[model samples]
Target chain A: MITLAVDCMGGDHGPDVTLAACRQFLNHHPEARLLLVGRPERLQGFAHERAEVVPASEVVGMDEPVEAALRRKKDSSMRVAILQVKEGRAQAAVSAGNTGALMAIARYLLKTLDGIDRPAIATQIPNMRGGATTVLDLGANVDCTAEHLLQFAIMGSALVSVLNDDPQPRVGLLNVGEEAIKGSEEIKRAGELLRAAAARGDICFHGNVEGNDIFKGAADIVVCDGFVGNVALKTIEGLASMIGGFLKEEFSRNLLTRAAAVVSYPVLAALKRRMDHRRYNGAALLGLRGLVFKSHGSADALAFEQALNRAYDAARNNLLERVRTRVAHAAVLPAAPDMASVPGATPPSPH
Target chain B: MITLAVDCMGGDHGPDVTLAACRQFLNHHPEARLLLVGRPERLQGFAHERAEVVPASEVVGMDEPVEAALRRKKDSSMRVAILQVKEGRAQAAVSAGNTGALMAIARYLLKTLDGIDRPAIATQIPNMRGGATTVLDLGANVDCTAEHLLQFAIMGSALVSVLNDDPQPRVGLLNVGEEAIKGSEEIKRAGELLRAAAARGDICFHGNVEGNDIFKGAADIVVCDGFVGNVALKTIEGLASMIGGFLKEEFSRNLLTRAAAVVSYPVLAALKRRMDHRRYNGAALLGLRGLVFKSHGSADALAFEQALNRAYDAARNNLLERVRTRVAHAAVLPAAPDMASVPGATPPSPH
Candidate 1:
């Protein structure tokens, strides 16, 4: 049976949203088991044959400082959930808690894989091709060198390969333009490194792609530093939210428009389904020694269940082994500082 | 009278679009006069009392290399249009031509303004507050220092002040988070510089904002390096296009959906008109000695006319003087190398 650890007392809704999702997730995946980690009082009511409650004393606040969560909240539900993965009791762990705190705890517990300097957040954004394009470093490692970018590309490739079941997924270096000479010096150098990796058969480099290319489905995987990736991701969220608000206002302005909205409900619903964020809720924290998935902090039960589904799939597919294999094959990666030895390394910024 | 030069032979539609836009623009603004620059053969057929034909021997192709457009096409329509502005015959210039070529030619001819290291493209994105937020460095300087970012904030303030008539526009430094400690070193330094500028009463600083803040209308102006700005801009375009395509597909799937589309036509049209990119076509190339506005290459007559309207507005409101006043008053800006003396400066990449 595939086992997953759940941070039950996490996210905006805490036990209310996560417990409901866990019950639904357990019902759907018959061969899967869950270790529900949270305050014993909160999770006592959630009892399932395939699920067991793992007691934790504290909960990480949505706006808690990373340092405080990492150093002070040693018994946080977020940490206890990841500890399951480190202890080999669970194949994967999923959380909807403070992103920075989660990443720090995951890194501290699982450490990073060999040849991987930083663990990146990989998520999917729906594209025009009726499929989602995988993008990496969504909000981890804000300042990245060319080597870091190259590593992101490799990690993204491995993740996409498993998600799409494609042995060789195409990777695109996110840049200002398609030309090699375009973008910052770091991006240009990353492009050269990616091309070299392609020559060595470590990745299938699709050259440089613009931000719009992420939605255009220009490549299966698009990689960039955390800052740009975060901006692009949030920009998409903002525009989509604006469009939603505009549609609602337009359809409710008058009696005639209200009737029109009723008539157009089916088409509008289809559009909404196509662009639903919940369907793409899970964000994999790749390059860590253990698999961890993050759900949006404000996710409902349905979205939280999607995150559980992703972690389950990643575990079953042996995603960590795939990443290790890809990183090992690519000999261009430079040696990185031992993160475990650096006690005061900068904490990751929240997504 | 507000006199503007038109690159009539530029963009994909060339005279077919620009000439038609010129005629319509003249009818709308009685006080505006246009200097239409293009080959004589194309200009001979059109005549207007307020608009004069200026002869240019060549046109810059959209995909032509920046170096070729700069060195080989001296008398190109794009060049002639800017020449009118340089010669004091016109207050501003408008083009729907090759972006990189236009920027290179404009910079080489007009030179950078004192205290400005690079020219940036500033444009508006529709925001949730039923207005628009002005963003700068859309696709100019790929790499930017804290000083360059501060310069962009000042330049953006001047542009928005003219566009909105707000004497003190609030400027936000775009970053991953609103927290002061959240982004890259450059972004952090930029935040500090912006705060310093605010203390000196040079700008109204709104602290750090995320990409969503652009649409949230959290600030009147948002500043970032060109790479991030370009990515944000193109990502918006791509998503908008995708949504448009999806709506069309959903509304045409079957007879039932088709009837529903007919019923919802008015509401749908309202949404389309609100989000139409044509209304926001003109992007001002700021930090130049003279005002130059860029329209989308594929713009139709209506969109091209909007570009003319922007240039006229900027000229009439004395945008250059406002920029000069802001830059001169700000004591933090470091002196830039004389662009005129740098004979072999790198050409701008295409927007």
Candidate 2:
């Protein structure tokens, strides 16, 4: 059975959202089991043959600082959930809690894989090809070197390979332009490194791609530093919400327009389902020795269940072993040159 | 009367688009005159009392390398057009040519303003508030210092004040999150500098804004390094196109969907017109001694006309003088220590 640890007392809704998602998840995956870790009293109502309640004393706040959550809240639900993965009791762990604290605790307990300096956050954004494109370093390292970028490309390749069953995924280095001479020095150098790795058969690099290329589906995997990736992700969310609002206003302009909206309801619903980001909720914290997936903090039952599904799939597919194999083959990720000195390069909390 | 120099032989469509735009622009604004710079033969067919064709010996290819275009194309139309601004023959210059070449020639001829280290590209993106958010460093300085960001905010404030008539336009530093300690060291330092400037009554700082804030209209002016800014701009373009394509597909899915589309045509058309990026085509090259505007290379007649209109408005309102006044009042722009030493920090080409 593919068993996963759940941080039940996490995210904005805490036990309310988590418990509902766990019950639904249990009904769908017959071969999957869960170790629900949270305050015993909070999870007592959630009883299933495939699920068991594990006790924890504290809960990490949505706005808690990473240092405080890691150093002070040693027995927090977030930490105990990851401990299940470290102890080999569960194949993977899932959380909807604070991202920075989760990454710090996961790194501290499980440690990073060999040849990987820092773990990166990877998520998929829906693209025009009726498929989703995986983007990495979503909000991890703020300032990354070329080597760090190269490592992200390799790790991302493994994630996509296991998730999509595509052995060789095309990796694109995110840049201002596609030209060889474009972007910051680190990006250009990363392009060169990616090309070299591609030559060695460690990856399938598609050269440089612009932000629009992410939605254009020009590459299967697009890698960027955390700051740019976060901005791009947020920009997409902002634009999508604005468009949704505009569509709603247009549909209810008057009695005549309201009739037209009723007629077009089927088409609109199909379009909405195709572009729904909730279907793509899970984000992998790759490069760590153990597999961990993060759900959006404000996710509802459906979205939280999607995260659980992704973690279950990653574990069953042996995603950790795939990443290790890719890293061992690349042999290019040199320990980031004193990661401590890179100002603001520490693991950052996600908004 | 305002006279603006035009690079008539620029962009992908060259004279076909630029000449048509100039005609419509002249008819709309009798107070505006154009000094069309290109091969005289290409512009000879057009005749207007307010427009005159100036001869040029060369043209800059859209995909030409920056160095080749800057060094080899001396008498290029792009150069002759800027020469009009430098020689005091026109109040401003407009081009839909290679961005890197345009920036190189504009900076080389006009020079940066006092206390300004580099010139930035500022453009407007339509927001939900029935207004547009002005974003800067679109594709000028790829690698920016904290001081460069501060200067961008000051210059962007000037652009908005003259164009939007908002004397104290709120400036937001683009980052991963809204919190003060959320981004890179340079971004953190830029936030401090902006806050200090706000304390001095030089600018109205809005703390930190994420990428979505540009579409949300959270701030009047959003400042970011060129790399991130360029990506945000392209990301919007890509996603908008994808949505447009999807709408077209859905409306033609079947006879029933087609009938619904016909009934809903008016509402859809209004939404399309509102979100049309062409209405916001003109991007001002800020921080230069002279006013220069850039149009999208692929812009058709209507979009090109909007760019010309923006340039006329900027020139009539004395955009250059406004920027100069703001910089003088701030007294915070320190000369960059060594721009040459920063790798890939040179002026970059826009896609």
Candidate 3:
């Protein structure tokens, strides 16, 4: 039986919404068990047949610093959820909590693979083709060296291999243009690394892709620095919201537009479904020692249930295990940072 | 009488499309005169009654380097068009041909206005409310400093004031978020500079705005590095294309949807007109000592005509003179760049 650990004290809805989702997921997967980590009293009212409570006394607010949260709130449910995966008690962990906290805890507790510097968070986003494209480092390591980007490419490509049975997942470096000469120093260097890696037959790197290329499905996986990745991800969400509001505003403008709106309701519904923000839930924190997923902070119970199902798949697939084996064998591990350098270290470049 | 310089060899469609647009524009405004600059023989057959042929011996292909094109193709129509603006023979110059060549020749011939380091291109894009917002530095500059961004804000604000009739144009620095601190080093620095500039009551700098904020008309002018600005512009255009394609695809899915599409045709038509790309044809290259405009390379005759009309407006408004006075009174001129450090200099940053 698979045991999925969850952080009940994370996200906007926190314990209540997360608890409801846990119950619903348990109902669906009768053989699955949950290790719900949070304050025992706060979770006392929730009763589920296949779930057990893990006593964690503290909570990390959405605004708390990731490292500070992990340090000061040692007993926080967020850290406990990830700790379950590290200690061999659970196969996978999921949280709709603070993303930075999940990543810090995952990397610190579970540890990175032999050749990985900083792990990345990879998510599948809806595309125009009704299919989805994978994007990595949505908020993992904001300052990445070219070499770190190379590792991200390898790890992200591995996730794509697991997601789609497509042979040799096509990879692309996210850039302002398709040219090799475009983008900043970091991106230009990363492009050369990816090109060299693609030639080596590790992954099919598909050259540079622009912001517009994401929706066009130019490649299977798009890799970027967490800063650019975060901006692109949020931009997509914000655009969907803007489009939704416009459609609603237009559809309600007097009798003529109203009549058109009624006739087009079914078509609009289908399009909206294809564009729904709730459909894609779990983003895996790749390159760590064990499985960890980050869900949306604003998610409700339904979205949380979707995350639970994702946790099950992530556990079954053994994503982190595959990443470790592939990266460890294909690339040489650079010397680890000294203890002093670790604290002030930004992500090293793949260059 | 308004004398507008037309680059007959400037656009993708070349002489044929330009000739048709000039003829149509002349029908609307009898006082308008076009000094159509290109190969005289090539344009002989298509010349309009109100247009006179100006001889030019060369053409700059879209792929040519900016500097080489200016030097080698000095006799080209694109160069001649700018010369018209510089020599005061024509009030304004318009081109739909090569962007780099146009900018190269314009800058080299007309030079920079007092206190401006780099000029920027501003496009009037359709917003959610059926109106438009002016976005700047579309592709004119790639790398930018904080001070350069401040200049863009001022120039974009001035354009909106003259063209958009917004007396106090609210400027927003395009960032990942609205928080002053939530952006890259350049944006963060630009924020402080903008705030200081705004405090003086010269221009209203609203603060940091995100990509989502563009279509929502969150600010009258959206400013950023040329690289980000270019990507954002293309991304928005790409989304419009995807949404349009999706709408059409869904409308043809089944008999029910087809019938609904028919019923909704009029409404869709109205919306399409309001969002029509042709209506917003010309993008002004701001911060120049002379008036210059770039039309869409793929623009049709109607769109091309609008480009000419836009040039007419800029010349009539005395854009260069106004910009000089504005900077002289309220804006600070940045120090000239130290030529030693310049390598593959993208756009100069507004610092």
The numbered model that scores best in DockQ is: 2
**If you assessed candidate 1 against the hidden native complex, which CAPRI class would it receive?**
medium
- Off-target runs (Cα >4 Å) in candidate 3 are A64-72, A104-112, A139-145, A333-351, B29-31, B45-50, B65-68, B330-343, B346-351
- In model 2, how well does chain A match by TM-score? 0.97
Q: Quality of candidate 3's docking, in CAPRI categories?
A: acceptable
Error of 2 at A214 (Å): 0.3
lDDT of 3 by residue, B215-250 (tens): 788888988767667666665666667777788888
The sequence of per-residue lDDT tens digits that candidate 1 reaches over residues A175-270 is 877877777777877888889889989899999998889999999999988888889999999999999999999999899999998999999999
Query: Mind giving the per-residue lDDT tens digits that candidate 2 earns over A94-191?
Result: 99998888988898899989998889999999999999999989888888888889899999999999888999999999998787888888889898
Q: Which stretches of candidate 1 lie over 4 Å from their true place?
A: A336-351, B335-351
Q: lDDT score, residue B99, model 3?
A: 81
Give the per-prediction TM-score of chain B.
0.96, 0.98, 0.93
Looking at candidate 1 chain A, the ten consecutive residues that score lowest on lDDT are A338-347
Query: DockQ score of candidate 3?
Result: 0.32
- TM-score: model 1 vs. ground truth: 0.97
What TM-score against the true fold does each predicted structure earn? 0.97, 0.98, 0.89
Q: Local distance difference test, per candidate?
A: 0.89, 0.91, 0.78
